[model samples]
Target chain A: MSRTAIWYWAARAAFGWLILLAAQVIWLVADTAGVPLSVHVTGLVATAVVAAAHVTVMPQWRYRVHRWEATPAAVFTQSGWFRQEWRIAPVSRIQTVDSERGPLEQLFRLANVTVTTASAAGPIKVGGLDRDTAQRLVAELTANAQATAGDAT
Target chain B: MSGPGGGPLSGPAETGWRRLSPRMLLVHPVQEVVRAAPALLGLLVAGTSSGGKGHLWSAAGVGLTVLFGMLRWFTTTYRISPEQVQVRRGLLNRKVLTVPRDRVRTVDVTSHVLHRVLGLARVEVGTGTSDRRHDSRLKLDALSADEAARLRVELLHRSPAGQFPGTQAPAGQSPTAQSPTAQSPATSPVSPAAETELARMRPGWVRFGPFTMSGLVTVGVIGGFVSRLVSEGNIDLDRVGPVRETWRWFSAMSLALEIATVLLALMVFVGVASTLGYVLAYGNFRLTRHAEGTLHVTRGLLTRRATTIEERRLRGVEIDEPLLLRAVRGARLSAVTTGLRSKEGGQRGGSTLLPPAPRTEAVAVAGLVLSHTPGATGGPSPVTGPDTGPLTSPLTSPLTVPLIPHGPAALRRRFTRAFGVHAPILLALLLLWVLGEPPLWPWLTAAALLPVTALLAADRYRSLGHALTSGYLVTRWGSLVRRRVVLRCDGVIGWTVERSFFQRRAGLATLTATTAAGAQSYQVRDVDLAEALRLAAAGTPGLLDPFLEPAGSASQ
Candidate 1:
């Protein structure tokens, strides 16, 4: 994973917290019910505290946990912070390979590569890659996938 | 012979478009009439209550339905080409759907009461993509029973060049290896070749019905309805004649007698309802192998269904033994096949090879379906053994092979998990009793649950086992719904090893084999990390080697 991934994660977390805070503010202003002012203030304070701690801690934890490797035979990825997952799908069973860059990812010049198979267990994603790395990975996967035979089922 | 349906009984190699059975015209109007009846009745009642203006609406509704129904029949036509099966439909927005003959995974022929009366059936062509949308399928609504039967055989039996010649019938058993003739009798006629019956629903098998507990759902529904009536103030048990009499009689009885009576009624009700449900769903169930590399399942009482499955698409088989069913030593066997719709497709029962029956029977049928060499028996020889050479079809029953237990770490984890979940609740209850002064008997009653949870956890641990055979990776788990899944090694597409925080601390990992078949992925939970990786390597050779790091090179 690229170092910029931390910035992207922090930005996403902060943005989410901002939306939540805005909603809380709107609810506070529109609260026609007889809720105490102290209670509303206390709720806001607690939410802000938790959100700040999360924004500070989560991205680094995720960065440490995430790892990926692509070999000729299979693509292996290790991801997730709390409950980790290790996925390995053979190139022969590779149905599709896609590289995507969301707005936040583009800001950090990072990309995500998704590898899919015919299984309903769903696709494997390797996020927080430099743009060029993502492109190269996608190209390599697509070449290998096309070289193989069978309908990936 | 030219029939009223305007198509030849058995057309040339590449037939042109053909319409549905003409008798379907009668079926359509009746179906449309039934759909419009509620509104028509409401309009008629409104006409009677008002100034009779609504009567015009009622007549117009009926007329429109009849016209629409007739138009539906006129606009629909289907044709079977050498390479593809196509259906063209729609009056205003015409659409044509085509499915390659090679992609056809299953051919289901179904006939409802009306269609049965008219000697018509519906043919559904399953083009084995995981796409569950109805629009993706090619269906001919009402074809002559003979034609439907022929279409199923024609679409499924024709082997495209270079495709697998799936599971040929034992050479001598099926005397005639030729394709079925069009003149063969239409009730999905057995080919001149001997039809091998795999399993049949016996009258004795009905005893397994109550164990299925299917009637429990009905009891819940009825209970809900009764509660709803009472809650909505629609009925008063205190005022109703039979209810008040029954309540008075019940209250007069001793508490133990009352409990026994209630238990007896519930048992009888469930027994009868489950028996009826079993009879309706699986009555005359038959699993047979046709000469043409296909397994045919014919079952159902009122709405008969015949589903044909290509043996090649079959990935494996699952033997499900729910807790109650296990208690009675009953089991259900289902085929794990690709291209077959899963539960989300509303065809969950399409892959069932055997309904609830004796566990021994289920095991035997599973063995038969999976066994490549006839008369083969005993456990499969270890493929990884030295000098074993190339893998051969197992001479052993995969289902009966003893599984490798997950060891004491998994057992300890199970107990920890059970206690972890229940201890807090127990503590909370104690706190409540001490602080809030709750009833002593209630707390004591709740404490009894602790022992049951421990037993469940122990059983769950006992159930966790996995084995890597020559042909299959068999994983067994779950106590409540104990399932032994034998998945073909070749069908495995990917591998996933997941470990939660607790599992990591315990040095345990969950290995999942992802496939395109039934349930998609089956997991062997709480195994040592090294063992998991080794299993993954053995399951799909050379797929995991490059990614594996040297000892102590990567994080443990």
Candidate 2:
């Protein structure tokens, strides 16, 4: 997996743990109001078990994250550890491409790249990259797509 | 004003020949009768129930009927001139509309069965604007067929002269003609051959038979059924039963006089309704091509409409063949043009140049109308083609290879195994349902399994083929209607590749592209990592190409 993919999962795990901790705190508060001590103990045990299960199951295949490579003829990206797969979009079929960044991405100095075609509702976004890298990638890919369109004419 | 011959030319030329359309005599009374039916019935019911105010109510009803008849008679008038056409009339507030020749788009002449018997046809001038915004510009009703034709020619001659009298240019020649090499024809009357050709192109009554009638019948039946259901709770079987009974009885009877009479009346009503629909839809249908590549179309039964489209304004063309039309080898062609708005506020009315025709005819009309070049035809063919392009490239190779410790094939096996693992859940539910003690939980769980299994199967099917070619990226993946959208590399306005939390767990990503037309954006779902980058690069080759010099690159 790419370092970015690992970071993404790590962030998810951290968020999941925060949710568990909140559940534990609510259980403790109920116990202090003299509702039930057994309830608090059961809640704590469940949270720990769930958190441990997630940590074990998620990191098993972390090596399949992919980076995109764009050429004059096509654009492609690959990801998957066990069932390796690839996607290619020829230049002629590409309708448009855009690069965007959200507030969270801005804080992390990262940007997302979105690509669109003629027949679909929403564009695909490839996120978790530095802003400059994302912009450069978008510019190059748009030029290649346009060149192919001109060739069709 | 007095003519050079010393005759007064104003005020309808003081001739009884300048009369209100005969259509007004026939239709205005019918409209009045229809509008008054409910009020008349209500008054009758009230007078019968109360037994008081009986004479007063009867007198009022007679007064209303007489008033309506007179109103219909007085509210219509039309006048024609060599230079202009004017229509003026109103019951309360007067409306006088004058349509100058320059603004008139098309003149349509049409006749109904009644009109055919009377030897009269309605001449409607469509000025390419709604009556609400523009004053009423068309003749109120039918005129003599010969007069309609004469008026059309007169308006055609007046238009160019009206706009630029000093130039003395021919009616067919425009300043913005596309071809510099082609010479314009000198001014002359519309040729006899052109008029004959138009008459030949007129849709005959025979052409409006089974298909049009069946469509009208279907709509009527469905509407009747729905309305009955809404008002009376369940459908009234009586209505359908009577229609069937009447038909059977009419056919079975060989000698019954009353049955013949009833069948004849029913047939007459059906005939009238169908003829009315045809007249309203195709009335005054006229298509004329001006010498300057502009096509004008005018049609309407009551509220006549006209449309004129310049050839240079067209952006794209769409040819549609619905299932029923396709069975009959018929097609409808329409051009998507820039800067033309349907005067109907995007609602129910617009004048189409060509009515639905045979496929070959539709194509010929399209070629004549749009002057389409060779290149615009390539996109539609590829959408239906079998050999789409290559599947992967180097940028996506790393995504296929194991980035973590386990590699990509193992992940697919895991997903496939997970799908297989869910099968027992269905069996467990079925077992509980089969037992004497019914388990509601199991049935609900099994019901949920159906969609999940279907979704997984679809995803697997989609993963089978994803590719790119030299000129375009062709992606084919849709569960309901298989769609293959080709995006030219340079055509890509913008693109995005996304992986959500669920997709991250499943090792899938989606790609989307935005194009110039705004409507033709592409969104490909659950694609492999390699395919997404290839699409992105192919969609934007200039930005993606590392070796290309900045000076040589084109700006998006």
Candidate 3:
């Protein structure tokens, strides 16, 4: 297994902008509801700065830091834009393997693979993979998990 | 099937689907009413405006609750074959849930005061899903006590691995063993040595009740209730204008007296609540080891519960000593076991093997339980005084030793973390000062807390130590509730290494051994990078060898 497609960052950036648009609308409505002009203006400005940082600067940083590896024995995921997390889920512990490509991801030809285990932290999501790669990973992981299902007990 | 309630609890000779006790239809509505009783004050305020209409809605609400209860009773039916359990529920949109026999973990029998009086109990089947969202496998609202116990034992016996299939079982025992339930129809006698009583609640333990955290919890509950009342406008000062003025006038009469009177009242209330909470939860606490490699825990007064955990599901044991309890030489013993936990979403609601007892007695019981338990081998290098009990020799148990204590670096790390938290608040205070007249009280409070924070950090650093027992890895930490866990190294599934930028700068990393047991992960926090790697490698030798070696670097 290898790294996810670079287009994943663009998909995430699209979500960031959508959230900014929602914030702007909420602030505008609040302003109409007799809210102070300064408060609304400050809120809009803060949202805009965050939106800009998220779409442009943060995505590049995220792409640099994010990583994933699917070995025969385990799947390792390095995620998070700021507080990075490195998670390792042994194939023996995997309960289910699923991949999804939503409306936003279809534009970028990317999909996310979720590997769930009965562990406390729940699932490990490997996002931004090319749709075909994600589907292949899911298949490979499912087979590997099935092989080791009863080996531990 | 619509027979009298006093028939054979097998339920009127049902053919395929078995309905719950007809008495169950009343249980849900009663529970709903009790839960909704708190919200009645808000309804009262609404009643003033709506008049009889509000009462009509309340009646409708009761009617709807009863309807739902009746529908639930009518629609819900279950079939338990030897291989699996199947249940179908939902009136309009029907649904079925199938839980395989091997997947069934715990079948707990619980009966509250109401259920006890009505000769009904609740049986919940849990698949060891500690994650709260998808936790309950099946919950039968009401059943006869005898049936509940039989069902629990039978369900547990069928799933021989005990909790779940994929977890470890006892030594040399396969998942499909002799059916204990069917074999022992008469509650057959067993060898005296095979069954040992681990811990039984003494009236003496109740002396430590008022010192526990129950008082604080009760205060919080009462505070929440009062705040809810105020928020709902039911206790608005404006509505009780003269009463409010009278309270003010009374307070003005003598401020210190007023405070003293309120404090005395609160103390009495909290004291009574704490004692009552202790009695209700831990009154008849008993931990006994059964013949068939199972530990049975029976406790509670107003609500009775009997939980049986397979020795195989147990990874190890945890001994927790809260500050107040520690000061009083008391401790609580819980298990670091897999699938023994139910996601009841309570802080204090797990397999608490030993309620707050004398430290020496708790240690003796812990020694006995661990020695009998499969994973835990011998009590770790005596943390308490030797027990001179005539019944059993506690000091003779093999003690775990060579507890590795962190060096000076850990102290520095803790102090840094504590000061890092304090710096921001101080900066905010400084900014507030610059904006206007400084808040003298806030600054003074911060100044007072500074020493306390430092002391707590030092204590936490003191608590940072790790030990490798014979079969389990013993890690001790935490300040408020000092938890020393003995986890079976063999049960560890994987390792998680975490290094934040700060930790990396400090040449430290946190190594967590992920297991299915206990909290699913036991962490060695803020240890040196090399030490963390060494521990991971030592805990599971060749598993972490790739990550520790340089070739793994190339792969990453």
Candidate 4:
């Protein structure tokens, strides 16, 4: 898998870990307030196991991780390990492209790019890219698509 | 020094005091009186009920109304400069707005009955996107018709050359007198030289038929009644009867007199609304053709609103013929534009320019507006332009698929089957009623079946054949009123195919085409799998290809 794909899995792992941590904190507080100690411990253990399983299973699916690609004509992303579906949106039809970075994303020097088309559905976001790289990719894709369209006409 | 050869310093001196037409005070007092009416009535009712200090409260209310009216009248002021128009007003937290000459989109000037008698019109100036906040924009009420016309001309001419401002040039100037290159800032020797001699103006106003006024009033009253019913339960019919009875005994003996009074109140409200619409639609109903080929429409009665149109920004034009207006050969023309701010905040900002005009003028006006802008071709016409390909046939369009099987035999079979299923339910209901065991089953069955039957009938009605001929796609569908929507293929924004589990089993899919404006969504359903794929491919060229291709090719 590519470095970007590894980073995506890492981010997903971190999200799962955060959820587990939150649950553990809640359980510990409940235990201190005279709740059953055994129940609190069981909840913490279950959360930690689920988080570890997510980190392991997500990285093992290399085919799903490797399926996303940006071309001059379209941007395609494929996920799901067994069923493996793909979604492609032509750049010419793209209405708007926006890049956003959250606090965690900023810390990781990453940004998410959402491309909106005139289709009824919500926009598609391709996450886990460095800010500068995402900007350059968007510009290059837009220019390439416009040039191709001009040539076709 | 102030003669023809004078320098900039010798020009007219700036005035610190802003002057507004005195006729504006008429509206100010009326607005104050209307706003205060509710409060005054409430105070009177409360004081009278308590049986003390009623006269004192009434006096205080009148004094407050007068003071507020005066404050409002004094605060409103507007000033026009060579490059910008600024309106500064408000008694406490003042708002100062500056609209640059170039940014002025459309100016609408209107005059109500009162303003017409006083020979004054209200001018509303609309600036693009940024000045969308309704209250913050500039409104000049009761300006002389001539001043409003002049301002409209100045705003139109100020935009870049080669753009259409939707207005005709002055009589003396040739249609193509101003060259686009000559007005370009890069080519021109002097920065502000083009400003002079750009103001040779023309006069014309757009007028709506009498039906438009009635429709506006009816729509307003219906909307008000519906909202009031939803928010504050039903009107007190008991209270209404007593009030009418009391009025009859006190003032009039005849029932005709009571009916007349109620009718008079409704008429007054409608008359005021319609008159307000008329005033805003007053002079310079003129759409000027700007040197830039953008159409600038300025009109208004109280607060003039100006809209600027760049041909490229316009998605499409909708010509509507309501049932009432159809006989008169009159239709309302509205252009859908991007970057429109919604009246309600945060909703989709789909801006439309509505100008009620004759059907005969629609094409001519649209052609004039589109002449100078880029990608201005590809409308619903048989003739093809250089930039736009031939209009596509609706029948063959990828977006148009059969909602049901199309053979005559198939149609007849489907119809009979639908009727057969409904007939049994109706018959069963009739039988139950005769037996007198509370016939509840039939009523319940009908209540459930009515919506489902309607849905089925609608699906059957919308089973239209579509074709793509040239650059246009023509779709024919309907049960009661058959409609043929001729759309330019290039204008189609996006398309999607939706399939339910039952539909998937039946080898049918629904294809929906989304365009820029209006509520009408083009949809065709219940086609074979192969046809669905073909139609989807045509609407969105590469949608199916990614899935069809070998797994690796799409991934990388």
Scoring only the A-chain of each prediction against the true A-chain gives TM-scores of 0.91, 0.66, 0.74, 0.71
Q: How does each model score on TM-score?
A: 0.82, 0.40, 0.76, 0.58
lDDT for B44 in candidate 4 is 67
DockQ of every candidate: 0.44, 0.07, 0.20, 0.13
Model 3 C-alpha lDDT per residue in residues B166-276, reported as the tens digit of each score:
322231222354433222211213334444677889998888787676877988988898788777735666567897787877768576788888888788887788777
Q: For model 1, how does the per-residue alpha-carbon lDDT over B254-362 read when each residue is reduced to its tens digit? A: 9899999999999999988898888888898999876555789988887788988766567788899999999999999988888885554224478889999999999
DockQ winner between candidates 2 and 4 = 4
Clashing pairs in 3: B381-B400
Interface RMSD against the true structure, candidate 2: 9.3
The prediction achieving the highest DockQ against the true structure is: 1
Docking class of 3: incorrect
Per candidate, native contacts kept equal 0.66, 0.07, 0.25, 0.05
lDDT for residue B351 in candidate 2, whole number 0-100: 30
List TM-scores of chain B, every candidate.
0.79, 0.45, 0.81, 0.54
Please tell me which model should have the higher lDDT, number 3 or number 4.
Answer: 3
| Residue lDDT tens for model 4, B1-556 | 1111122211122442254566556666666776666566667656766777866887798778877877775886666655567777888988888876545555656566666666666677765543345687578765666555555555555434224334432222212332232232222222223221111112321234343555356657678765555334334544678867876574754668778876776666665665455445533344553444344555554444445554444444444455334445555444544323323211211232334455556434543333323442222212233132111222332223232343343244345556678878777787778888665766677757866776666545444455544344445454433333445455555454455555544544555555543332455544444564555455445544655454333222
lDDT of 1 at A76: 88
Model 4 chain B — which ten-residue stretch has the worst lDDT?
B1-10
lDDT, model 1, position B74: 90
lDDT by residue for model 2 over B1-556, one digit each (tens)? 1111122212343341255544445655555665575565556556765787755886688667756765755775656553456776777877767775545555555555556555556666765332454355475456655555445554544333334344333333222322332212222134422211121134554243333343456457657666744444333545688867977876776666766786776566555665565566557666655543345566666644445444323333344444445556654445443223332412223435455456566555544443321122112222212111121232222112112212353246435654666767766767778885676776787767776766755543543334454344445443323333334433444455566655557656666654432134456666654555555655454434552232143212
